[model samples]
Target: MTRAYLAFTETGLALAKRLAVALPGSVARCGRDGVSLAEWASAQFVHSDALIFVGAAGLAVRAIAPHCKSKTTDPAVVVVDECGRFAVPILSGHLGGANDLARAIAAVCGAVPVITTATDAHGIFAVDEWAKHQNCMVLEPERIKLVSGKLLAGQPVYYRADFPVMGTVPAGLFLADTPEKADFALTLCPTGQALHLVPRIGVLGIGCKRGTSAETLEAAFAAFCTRYGFAAQAVTAAASIDLKQNEPGLLAFCQAHGWPVRFYSAAQLRSVPGQFTPSPFVQSVTGVDNVCERAAVLDADGSLFYPKFACSGVTLALACRPFAPDWRWQNA
Candidate 1:
């Protein structure tokens, strides 16, 4: 669990104590009231995901904002009254903020929670959480900010493949067709279909030996991700498993990646029209199919451009696309 810090007036210290008991992570309280604001802020800066202020909103904001990381990927900030009856999400929900924590506090204190972020209210795809689950790195975190800005202002967000996002479009901005133009574009796993906007595809592919151990597979996959600059969460789906479902390695791979193993049966592969290639070993071992050939064949809506590298044992494919403007996470 991430560490959380609470700096409150004497009246609010009891609330902080309650929070420390309920929230499993480490918690701290501010010292003497007369201490310098800088001293207070700096004291809790280490490894704390949130800075909770129990009183004096203006002072709390000013004192911590300057100390926060410039881009603010960590250490969210919040403010509440001494009664603990009103909780406000001041910063950093996606990077670990007081949004949920504040809400938890509010539930305990019966306070009103102020959460204005669209994703949380609408219950859509939280790109950051997905990234966290997949262990994928975000190339451009600010793009999500721009995307949310447009959404909050009632702008249209276009998804090439209807990728689920946090908020709904505000009517006027949603463009249904390619208008020979668009305000912004989002691609979902590159279908090669004629899209009005630029393509942004997320891909997941996998390969594996007949009987690789689950532990070996997981360690190898993690190492593979670290070695190649890629986020595990960006994996949209598992691309192969038909011949290897019985293999513990393949099943473990699917579970680890949080994807349903999409197997292409031999008959299904035969139906998919492609410049299909077959390997002797693949045909001999699996008896019914080829892995890459089947994957390419199955992806009828989009063309599969095979990279020149061969992943031995078990192969798990993931999107290589760096995150774009729409794919971002922010504090709620």
Candidate 2:
């Protein structure tokens, strides 16, 4: 991950330099640079993956206070004293990986790592960390505490996965075959008030009529997800036939969702082996019997879970890549 080190003193700058060496792709900047701390931090907060402040924790906190946004999007913030005696992660500890970054920084400088997150402090299972490591996206981030709090309080946190998960289950977590008995659920179609997690394995394949408006495409896509009980966040990317590569509406819809679109040729779609819902009309125009389903399977390199559903001049399909959950935790 890209990181930047900010130092306010000679001692800190020296430590920053050493820390930067231990972590590659990191640059050390000292107060000698004409930029004010706030200005420098504002720019780096948006650009850097992690920000290491070689100064007091208070100074680091104050500097990053204004720029702090959602924990999901903010850069990991770590602080180390000029003496290099302690490394503290004061912000975005779990989802933003500040806790992990603090440990790394402390190890590099022989400093004590101060991690204060309740789950980490108690040595209990952290659902968010586990989901991140397993390449799963949390849908209701606000409800994360609902699950983690129960686990930390020695309460059971039940869960159920829509997909297959291998490996020994962690303590304090029970897998229920039913969603109603679970505190959290791993699924695209979530029920009840349980915290919902979607594995980042779905690929969406789309086909739209020529000159279809972006609004039309978006509404169709939303309806498709609602109809099939799939979370839009589960879809990591999109695919389509090459004939629609320049289709402005299709491209805009994917762009707005931050999903990159991969265009496959008609011949390529035909080569994808599957019993697709043949479409004579689609074949007449796009030279393929199916566009959405075939492209989805090809892009995912996995089985198509949802066949094509057509509506309002748009077609949508969903394919999912393989996923296997484990107990190990790492900042992904």
Candidate 3:
């Protein structure tokens, strides 16, 4: 569903076409003789996840200047020369993935990637980039600059993780035993501390009575997470029995939070092995001894971090993915 737009002038239209062919699901847009470049670029910026301008860097800057927002929301913007000699990420380089996109484009065009991010240039680990790679939500994204700045200045940045992290720790980052002693921390649960990176690794398994109001479900879910130290931003998905697939409150809650819901059949739920709370009434009605626990760990091998907690006619459980260090971009 990701759409990339390639905008080009007459001099670079052929190269843009080649790039469009190289990148699947990409659209090649050229400035017509009568259309204004600014207007055309503006339209592309609004409609695309990434914009590649096959022309001057000045043109790319001027086109995106009016529409540029924060790195969190802006689309990746890359500028390539008409001869395809260099690919430069002009805006939203790290958080928006412009740097990676530029490198890919450069590789295809046999050109050089002109990445200038301080961390990338100096071969230091960028926390923001790593968080993005891990599908984690940075609660305080501004603090990333503070941590990266420390590393850039040759000051060791301390870190702590609640779960086991594999692979050798990147240079410039040291592991600390406690949050108080660390410069920053990585966790799935809330710590009420600043400079913490929360990974989106929690899955919620929910069961609700029919006709439950969305408000009731929301309040109960929020309370359950708050009571158990779960970070709301760390929740990545939800699950429930297939029988409740059309339940209005459940659907509404997941949809509102942009979490995808996975529905398991009674047989599917029964096949998962775990020590789950069994309810005769639930089994009589749904043909499954448990829904919340089984649904939470259906697809992945995970631990039931939070057992079933019931409130306001709703039952909930939580599961966590195994922690693994992502070191693919350590030197990039």
Candidate 4:
């Protein structure tokens, strides 16, 4: 179950008391003293996903920001003024809270739930939630957005695993491995000595300035993949190189994968429509070219997708497959 916390004054605490009735997880409160609110909120941050600060909503946001452990993992922070006048979801709307929590607060406290996550508003199966549904382990858990971003930007998921097997992958999912008779690929380890394949997948793509050397590109790819928890074989497909072939990183990625690099021209990428906030570097690397946008558009045949990586020197994308349902040992 997801966790939540409530920090508020006397009136805010009153509103919180009513709102807490509907919350599924635990909720804690700070007394009138603001000092305790910070301490209580900090301790609760360890386990909560939704934090509702019920006083001066804006001040609550500022107070909680400092105590948040890490932005990514930090619990969702929301602010609702005393008297149940206004409800505002301050942080982590999509991954953890903001929507459901706001709705619950609104229902209990008679306030408005101001939510802004496009996917949630639009009823799209969140990439992270979808992965969980398929029982596929999230390789780069952080890259969950890469899939959604790509889909929002109008890209199909081009997937190529080491083998052919499908259970419930999204639309436009590609089976790039050779046509062969196989139940599943070994995900945990391929060695005969091992018995089970761990639930695993990889999203591979790249971002580089014009003229990045193939060697440097390969190193970056290797490092990125390792950092993101992917085995080389788990890579489904090499996303199309940006139209700029001058990019050695793109070329090197193609050569290393031993696959025909799918190239999406700028016009084609821009033409394939969707709504993702393109990164500045993507605009820079592609020279009016969006590397991830173009790559994902070319890769995604028609699958619900998202972009996973956004780091210096590399703008990578992730393509995933469903994890194996059963892991019985087999002798060949």
- TM-score per candidate: 0.48, 0.93, 0.91, 0.44
lDDT of 1 by residue, 1-332 (tens): 45454555667766766766776444445565465667767766655666777776887888776667743365767777878778887777654645666777687778898886676676554444434333344445655555455555665555332334445443434544662334333433222222212222335555567678878667766765665544454455556647755877768766876666667666665665655455677667766445653553354245554431244565443433333333333334
lDDT of candidate 2 over 76-105, digit per residue (tens)? 888899999999998888877889988988
Candidate scoring better on TM-score of 1 and 4 = 1
Please state every model's RMSD to the true fold in angstroms.
9.9, 1.9, 2.4, 18.8
Alpha-carbon lDDT, every model: 0.56, 0.86, 0.80, 0.55
Model 2, CA-based lDDT: 0.86
Model 4: CA > 4 A from native: 2-4, 24-35, 69-72, 83-87, 121-125, 132-137, 159-332
Q: Candidate 3 or 4, higher lDDT? A: 3
Say which prediction, candidate 2 or candidate 4, comes out ahead on lDDT. 2
Cα lDDT tens digits, model 3, 238-262, are 9999999999888999999999999
Superior by lDDT: candidate 1 or candidate 3: 3
Model 4 reaches what TM-score against the true structure?
0.44
Tell me the RMSD of model 2 versus the true structure. Answer: 1.9
Relative to the true structure, candidate 2 reaches a TM of 0.93
Q: On TM-score, who's better, 1 or 2? A: 2
RMSD (CA, Å), candidate 3 to true, equals: 2.4
The alpha-carbon lDDT assigned to residue 212 of candidate 2 equals 91
Q: How many backbone clashes can be found in candidate 3? A: 0
Ten contiguous residues with the weakest lDDT in model 3: 1-10
